[model samples]
Target: MANPTTPTASVTCSALSYQWPDGTSVFDGLSLSVGRGRVGLVGANGSGKSTLLRLLAGRLRPSQGSVTIGGGLAYLPQNITLDTTPRVDQALGIAERRAALRAIETGDVREEHFETVGDDWDVEERALATLGSLGLGDVELDRTVGRMSGGETVLLCLAALLLERPDVLLLDEPTNNLDLVARRRLCEAVDSWRSGVLIVVSHDRDLLERVDRIAELRSGSVTWYGGGWSAYEEALAIQQEAAGRTLRAAEADVRRQKRELEETQIKVARRQRHNKKMDAQRRAPRIVAGERKRSAQESAGKLRGLHEERLDEARERREEAADAIRDDAEIRVSLPHTAVPAGRTVLSLRELRPRFGRLLRGDLHVHGPERVALVGRNGSGKTTLLRTLTGELEPLSGEARTFVPLRFLPQRLDVLDDELSVAANVARLAPGITDNHIRSQLARFLFKGARAEQPAGTLSGGERFRAALAATMLATPAPQLLMLDEPTNNLDTASVRQLTSALGSYQGALLIASHDLPFLESAGITRWLLLAEELQETTAEEVRDLLEAAAAG
Candidate 1:
């Protein structure tokens, strides 16, 4: 159900139903209304958060419903690409107005220039202000898009949307690959939003914390919660606690009803035996005895039916109670083979210079089972360094060496073959491993039995990440050092927790490149390396300070 009374700048979807061309249904008669405020849309992977955003943005049409918008709208999708040849002013959509202003400044006095400029004479000023708000103030209007980093481009696109000044704005996974500074800038933009319907679909807990409310999309329905992520979590905790209690009570009631039914049956049997004995002892006539037996049988039947009905009702209640509880299973696996000796050298780098990114030269050394967190701004050579270490990319001048077996899981997760099943993919990675062994390990990663047979391409975002991780970690020769790049880019919170749980079992050296500070802290990172012109050893606290200081400057 939706609130039809929402005024201007609101969005309403009525009986919305959407199905993929393959006949996979996403939403069925789903409806919700979003009024003026910041609304954070949160849900599990494959729960239709992105799809719902698309529908609202008018990028996709519903199969059988209506979407009504009370005002103008703009959308910033998860993946963004801009023409590299376009200048900053052109991309921001203010080039024409700027040219018109220039023409008038030159004293051309053209009527066409006046018409194009209209009331938006301050377009360039507003564009510059918007770009500055998104941490792009240093960029010049004449700069080409090709020179900007991927993250900068995303921010630039967002800047374009902001310049539109639409009544409604939709953003999907806006912070996927953004570094800490970029994230902070995006957060500031979200905080400054006012007087419109703002809906963002994202798994970033920090971003969600800035929202006015939360709209959770689950099972094709929207459940509204007041406040941000913390409040929603607190409310859900209370609900689950109550549900657990009800389930336990229902189970006890079922057991009680079963016992009562058994006792009643025993009593009826004894009474029947006694009645026959009494009839025989009294030497009653045959017709009289027959009538008594028939009446007793009828009474026994009614009593049995009553107890059976009670038991049935109790069982039904138990089922309903059980259904109310959520089962978000965790991944639990052990990898003892990955353990390294305390004094053993795991990795070493000497004056290494990757072919791309900002690092000119760097030196590093890893020992034992040290877990290192790679922290830096986007385009700071983190990925390039990892690739060079893995021998996937050639370095310009120095050497990178690993003393033990290692594996790298890139952000793209291209390690998996889409055509293969989860189990088959693991088998492909770990040659000579038995099918039973792979299946058993896959089960620990939460891909049990038939689920392991699902094609890698068909898996959802979270499931695919788990599968890729499993394949990388479960390979033969047992990688003593594991590396991952932006592993939590688009993962939901539950999935992130699952990944952490899985990593807990790996007794190896870990090098993870990520901007997610909370995750890095939770993963027990023993060292933090900042990627800049040089590789500097730092602490988590220092990393946060550096990002904040950089953003402020």
Candidate 2:
């Protein structure tokens, strides 16, 4: 669906068509227009959301179509890598202007310096303001990019974009790498957008809630919803309910039509038999009898054709109604062996300090099937702790131990081999498991039949995540202690729900490190650990309060 075009700023794609080099079509004859407002672009992973953004940003050309923008455009792609040598000012695109202004202040009186400075004499102030808005105010202008955290780099890149003041801005998964604090800053930046067209593609529900409208891209088309995430969900629920009723009605109609057709055939057959008997009893001339039989057969044929056509139309209606309903499958699997006893000690940490991040010392003990949420700010060592627990990284001082079999699903999801099929990856992880059993279990993860045969690298973001998850949980020893680091990073809303559903069936202890509070809460986190200079036990509310207080400061 296309909204009203903005007089000041507009983005429109006309008869868009694109295909991969290997001849797979991603979009065909797709078109959409955006006016001046915040639009949350949502879709399943690999539904062409990123590709569409790239096309709009002029980074990629469509096979056949035209993208017209009313004004300047800026794009922030999903994966960001900034040069380490550049200072914060240079990264923000204002270093040269600042230099020119400084030269003039030193009484250089050079025409070239004045020309470089131009009318933007306050560029440095604006740059600082943008940086401050993105939670980077403490960062000095001359600070090297290498010194900043991963989350800070993302916000820094966004600050640069804001400095451009483009008429149309596109952000693809902007919150993926950000911590809670940086995410809030990004949300504030989105909330402050009052002009131009701001289109952001993200799986972050909190961020999506800040948008003016939602544009759901599905099946190579865009559907517009009036409000934010909650509103869109409500509207979608109503639509699905109506579609279900319509489907039921259409199915009934089809059955009724089929019955009518059968009855008609039966009645016509009986009538023909009775007419033949009557003709024999009348003993009319042979030619007259033959003509009467021919007419009866033709009439029966017409009646059958009419009923058949009605049935066909009813079936068509049923198909259309079914198409209106979404069938996002949920993962459902059971592993009795993974269940930890109530008194079993799952994990123990003793004054452990990881090799990375800011955690100085950590001591924790977990028992049974406890669900723990590892919450902290960026650079606070959430990932470091998970890695240490998994034995991928040795603790600097103390030891981390897991009593039961364990598995770790990192943010990168590098467990799967790129060249192997999904089923093969699972099989490799789970030695001695029958291929039939592996395939059956994979089906529960929504990788049914041929999907399980696809190479790991060929899968989409959501698919890849599911594939990795299946390999992790279905390992031979049955991971009684399952540790995940940022598991919901790039998953769509549906995929996130699926992950939660899958975890619901998991009978093992969970230790998840994530900044997504909603997801953590839904996962039934029994304990929350705040990882900073030390590991502190905290609650979900307390975590939120701390983040908010920090942001306020």
Among these predictions, the greatest TM-score belongs to 2
Name the regions of candidate 2 deviating beyond 4 angstroms: 1-7, 279-289
Candidate 1 lDDT, 1-553, residue by residue in tens: 1222335888999999999888999999998988899999999999999999999989999999999988778899998878999999998888988999999999989899999998887888889899999999999998998889989999999998888877888999999999999999999999989858999999998899999999999889999999989999999999999999999999999999999999999999999999999999999999999999999999999999999999999999999999878778889998999999979999999999999999988999999999999999999989999999999899999999999999999999999999999999999999999999999999999998999999999999999999999999999889999999999998998899999998899999999999999999999999999999999999999999999998887
Weakest ten-residue segment in model 2 by summed lDDT: 1-10
Model 2, 425-506: lDDT tens digits are 9999999999999999999999999999999989999999999999999998999999999999999988999999999999
Residue 220 displacement in candidate 2 (angstroms): 1.0
Against the true structure, whose lDDT is highest? 1
What C-alpha lDDT, on a 0 to 100 scale, does residue 16 get in candidate 1?
Answer: 99
In model 1, which regions exceed 4 Å deviation? Answer: 1-7, 272-298
Extract clashing residue pairs from model 1. none
RMSD of each: 3.0, 2.8
